[model samples]
Structure formats: C-alpha cells, structure tokens
Target: MFLLLFVVAFALTVNSHSYHRNKYITSANFFSGTIYSWKSDVVGYFKLKERNNALAEENRRLRSLLAEARDTVPFIALDSTVFPGPYQYYPAKVINNSYSKTKNYLTLRKRIGDPIEADMGVISSKGIVGIVNKVSNKYASVQSILNTNSKINAKLKNSFHFGTLVWDTQEPNEAKLIDIPRQAPVVVGDTIVTDGKSTIFPRGILIGTIKDFNLSNNQDYYDVTVQLFNDMTNLHHVYIIENVEKEAIQEIEDVEVKAPLQNRPTESIEETNQENDAE
Candidate 1:
C-alpha cells in the first residue's frame, strides 16, 4: 500500500510540471543531433578522396576543351588530321611541398612513363608554381618559384615591358621583378604575367600583382614587388605544361654560326656615331 501511494505521487508531480516535460524533450533532441553529426563527418571523410579525384578530372577536361577552342579558327576547313597545339597540359598531385627555406622545392607524384620532362612549367589554377628540375621513374621534383635561384620572364599585363621574375627569400608569397625599364608605366595593383619569351610558359599566364615599386640603386630600371596568387605553403594539385615545339625551337637556336673576320660587315661612320651617342 505504501509503494502504490509513492508511485501515484511521483506520476502526479511529473505531469504537473511543464518544465520537466520540456527538459526531457530537449535532452533527447540534443543527443540525437550529436549522433547524426558524427555519422555525417565520418561519411564525408571517407568520400574526400573520391571527391578530389572527380574534381581533378573535371578540371583536366575543361582545360583540354579550352586548349582546343583556342586552337580552332573560324571558317577553317575540317581535315582528317588533328594538328597538335603548341602547349599540352597534364595534371599531377603535389605529394610534398616546402616553403620555409632559402631554396625550397616540391615533389610531384608523376612517373617516368608520364610525358613530363625537365624544364617544363608547372602551374596551379591560381598561378605559376614552379619548374620541373628532376624526374625519376617514380616521382618528379620541382624547383619552386619561392627558391632563391628561380627566375622567369614576366611582364606588365597592361604594357609590353618585360622583366625578370625572382624571389628575395624574405617572403614566400612575395617576389621581385627586375629590369623593368623606367619608361614603362607602373602602378600598384598592376597585374604581371608571363612574357611568352620562352617556349615553357605561354603568354598571359598570371604571375601576380604589383604590391610596391622603387628604382634600383643604379636607377636604370624599376624594382617591383609582386604578391603571388597561390599560397606556396599549401599546395595540392598542379598542371605540367609541355611545349610541343620546344625541341624544334631549341634545336634551331643551338646551331652556332661563325663568320670569318674578313667577311664581317663594318659599321658605317654614321651608325658608329649614333651608337656612341646612345652609349
């Protein structure tokens, strides 16, 4: 009889208090939400690799389409032969990267069987990354643009003035552009791009924007600071660019021409005077 009376009192107390019922419902919802969140996180983690692969493949396809579109000409005749473009791109994963050294390098997961070769240009979606220095059957090493020895031909996007791109080892995301003649117009926030002087990188490939500028000690040219688009410390995907005509162009340039002193043309008096005056 005592146990029955206690049970009835407990039930009446719970039913009389709306706070107790609301607290019970809130606790149950919170516990379920946490469980669902954990489950979602685990599933997402497992699908990460798949998602990345899909994204890379999609990018490759789009790049190929763009290349083809650029190669195409309006009102051109269709032929059975497909002429290859001057540049070809191959996607690769950056397995290792280093940005905190005077001479930093990156390692890529490309094998010897791949069409990649030394001196080829490497770029990410945002901007230039580095150049391939060494390639083995299992991997390839890149000389990062952040390295002290890195140099590439870059130019002002709005003008034809070109300069040499170099790193000062002071900052990973910043680089220096030297040898820009004083006559060229320069302003902060101007875009810099590859000059297409070499067969490696094509013209108009983005390098960075001008952050600051000053005349060098000699005062013959301007020294410009560039802020890179890519975060050198964090990298994952990159594309290796191969110049299809690089070999042909290099071979033609390698042939040395020699002329006997007797056959060499002499400078005219007027030309000599002009050269002296310019000097």
Candidate 2:
C-alpha cells in the first residue's frame, strides 16, 4: 500500500510540473519529426527522376505559351482565320554533348514524329545553343556554338549594329563577334542577340553579353568578345525551333537568285557616246 501511494504521488508531481510535461512533449515531437523527415527524404529520392520529368514538361508548355504570346501578331485574313506563330517549338533531351573538341556537337533525343530537321535552331532557357545539322528518325545532331566553324549572325540588343558570332576554340563560354563596324557604340556588358537575318532563329534571341572589344586587323571592324549566358558544358533540356515558313521563304529567295535582270546594257553610256563622236 505504501509503494502504490508513492507511485501515485510521483506521477501527480511529474504531471503537475510544466517543465517536465513540456520536456516529454518536446522529446516525442523531435522523435516523430526525425522519422517523418527521413521518410520524406527517402520518398523524394525515389521520386526525383519523376519530378524532373514533370518539371521539364511544365517548362515546355510554359515556353510554348510564351512563344505564342510573344510572337503572335493578330491579322484578319479574307477567310477570317487567325494565324498562329510562325515558329514551332519541340522539347528534347540531350543525349550526348561534346565541348572539348574543335568542332563540338550535341546529340538530342526527340520524339519520332517531332518534325525535327537540319538547320533548325536549338536553344535553352537562357540563350542559344546551336543549329541542328543532322537528323535521323529519332535523333538530331546540333552544331554547337562552341565549335570553331560555327558562325551565327548576332547583334547588339540596344542597337542595330550586327556581326557574325564565332568561337575561337580557346574557351567554352566565350565567343567572338566579328565584322561589326568600328563606328558601333559597343560597350562592355552590352547584351548580344540574334539578328534574325536568317530563318534559323527569331530576332532578339539572347546570345551573350559583350566582354571586351578591340579593332580587327584591318582596323575596319571591331572584334567583340562575348561571354555566353548558357553554360555550354552543362546542358540537359533544350528546345528545337522550326520556322514554319522556312520553305516558302527559301523558295522565294531561290527564285530571286535565279531570275534574270531586265533592261541589261552591254556597253557603258560614256563609251557609246565616245564611239558616236568618233564615227
């Protein structure tokens, strides 16, 4: 009887003490919280790939919407049909990339029916990647901008001064912009972008920022160094851009090239007048 009374008195004392009760509650919570944290970490580790895929898909969708919003210009046709954006984007995964070589290339895994073709532009969320050079049934190869032979038309983001973008094979993240007139007001940290001179990429797609500049050998043009925005060595997901009107534009260009000039003159007017005076 005396032991039972002592046990009841101890229990009442422990329960009545706020510090002891709070300590017990804190210990229980810490134990449970640790277990929950471990369980969540394990589950998250298992679901990492799935989550990455979901995020990639979400990014693709958001990019499509953004392209439509940015590129769409409404025009009323005779049939009253609204035309969509001229460029189509397809999400792809990088299967292989090579930046160490003189002519670096990247292989992409695309859906079988994705309509990916050579000359298409490849880009990441940050900036330009390369141009598609070859395509197979389910894969395409890109000529990365880091390659020595890569030449893209790029311009200043704030002005119309344009030049050809090339890589010097010295650094993976640095490229050269040549043929820009020396008169251009180029400054360090100025943004460089695609000039849209060709159908490969749209106008104003980011390329990089001007790192430095110097006059070329002839002193007629400026050779500007650009620091790329995209890390060329660490690429994963990319978007393949296809210009829908590429064929039609190419056809028109070809015809213009082949067409004969009208009202041709075989002799100069000055020569003709001199010959007439001699006669």
Candidate 3:
C-alpha cells in the first residue's frame, strides 16, 4: 500500500511540472512575436535619423574639401612686373587637437597629396593655429600654438619689437610672449600680431592682446601674458598654409655657397706672419 501511494504522488508531480513548462513556453513565444512586430516598425524611424546624420556629416566634409581645392590651385595675382605665381590653399580639418595643457598638438587628415609638410603654418577664419610638424598623404600633424614646441614671431599692435608667442598650456585662451625688454613701454591692453618674419605666415595676423605680465626676478626680459585670438579647444575647420614661397626661401637660406671672405686664405696667413714677426 505504501508503494502504491508513492507511485501516485510521483505521477502527480511530473504532470504538474509539465503543465508549468508548457505554459511558460507559450507565453514567451506570444510576447516575442509582439516585440518583433513593434521593433520592425521602429527600426525604420531610427534608420532615417541615422541616415540624416550621416548626410550632414558628409556635407560638411565635402564643403571643406571644396575650399581646399580652390586654395591649392595655382593662382597668380594680376601683376605687370612679376612672373606668374602660385597662391595655393591646402584644405584640411582638425581631426584631433590638444589644448588647456602646458603642451598641445593638433592632428589633421591629409597626405603627401596635400603637399603640406613640416614648418608650414596653420590658420583659420578665426585666427592662427600653429605650424605643421609632420604630414602623410592621408593625415598631417600640427604643433599648435598652445604647444610648448610652438614658436613664432609676434609683435605689438604698432611696435616692431617682435619676440615669440608661445602657449603656456596652463590656460587655453592665453599664451606668453617672452624676451620683450622692460623698456618696450607696453601697456596692459596692447594687441599682438604675427610680425611676418618668416615666409610661412603673412604679417599683421592677429594673435592676442597683452592681458598683463610681469618681470621674473632674475630675467632681463618681461614675461607678457597674451590672450589668444582663437578658441583652440574647439577647432573644427583649418587651412594648412602652403606659403608657395616658403620652400624657395628656405632653400635659398640653406644654401652652403661659400661667401667671398673679407681676407683671402693666403692674405690672412701673410698678415698673421707679418704681425708675429713684428711682435
């Protein structure tokens, strides 16, 4: 009798478990079918939004390319006395950039095809950025004015005692101009600009204003505080300056041609012997 009772109990438990399992599978199937239908309808909406976003991004990129092409084309201004010249603008975008640090750098998407290379200055409609350090066909890197590696000639609004404007990296909006003698008579609000000492950049480009400054305890030069003209942290569009004349100027300066000596080698030796004999 006990064995019969046990058998009946086991049969009931097995039946009960099967019923629950069937019910769970039925509910899950029903719920999943509903969800699938709803997902199909909403999928189109999300995809449309994605497509629009992609289009906008592509449009921005195309416009940037167009501008660069215009600059790179050889264009000579109307001049009666000068030969044909090249005024090229290589377009590039600021893909990555660093600022708000003591040192900063900017990376651009360009290749050797862009013909941009080291020592080329960068700028935008806003203002100057920095010089090019490295370039590849599909990418280029810039040394931002905010970077400690950056060094460029800058001057006061009306004065010509141009030193160098450099990024301290401690402040994004500010840079430092060093080696201005204490006698420059600089005021707190004087403006600073590129002095055009190098062919990479044109003269009179806006830099910043003399916010304030002081002299270091032991240095003869005044440490000037400058407010940068551009918001480098939010760089978007930029132009890689080709300065068509830059290469020619650099080549001329780098030439190792022997200059005529004031005293020839033989003349110098004879003069030295005569002086020694006299002594």
User: TM-score per candidate, in order?
Assistant: 0.68, 0.68, 0.60
* Sequence-dependent TM-score of model 3: 0.60
**Model 3 lDDT per residue over 164-221, tens place:** 7876768888889988876677888888988886787878778888999899567777
State each candidate's clash count.
0, 0, 11
Worst 10 residues of 1 by lDDT: 19-28
Candidate number with the higher TM-score (1 or 3): 1
Model 2 TM-score, 2 decimals: 0.68
Tens digits of lDDT, candidate 2, 1-279: 999999987876564332211222221133433454455456556657865885687689789987786678664344546556789999986666779877777877777799987789999877899988767666676788987667899999998888999999989999999999988999999999999878899998899999999999999999999999988987767899999999999998676445434334534644665686444
Which pairs clash in the backbone of model 2?
A: none
Off by over 4 Å in 1: 1-80, 256-263, 266-279
| Ordering by lDDT | 2, 1, 3
Model 2 alpha-carbon drift over 4 Å, by segment: 1-81, 260-279
Local lDDT at 166 for model 3: 73
Worst 10 residues of 3 by lDDT: 19-28
- The lDDT for every candidate, in the order shown, is 0.77, 0.79, 0.69
Off by over 4 Å in 3: 1-87, 255-279
lDDT of 2: 0.79
TM-score, ranked from best to worst: 1, 2, 3
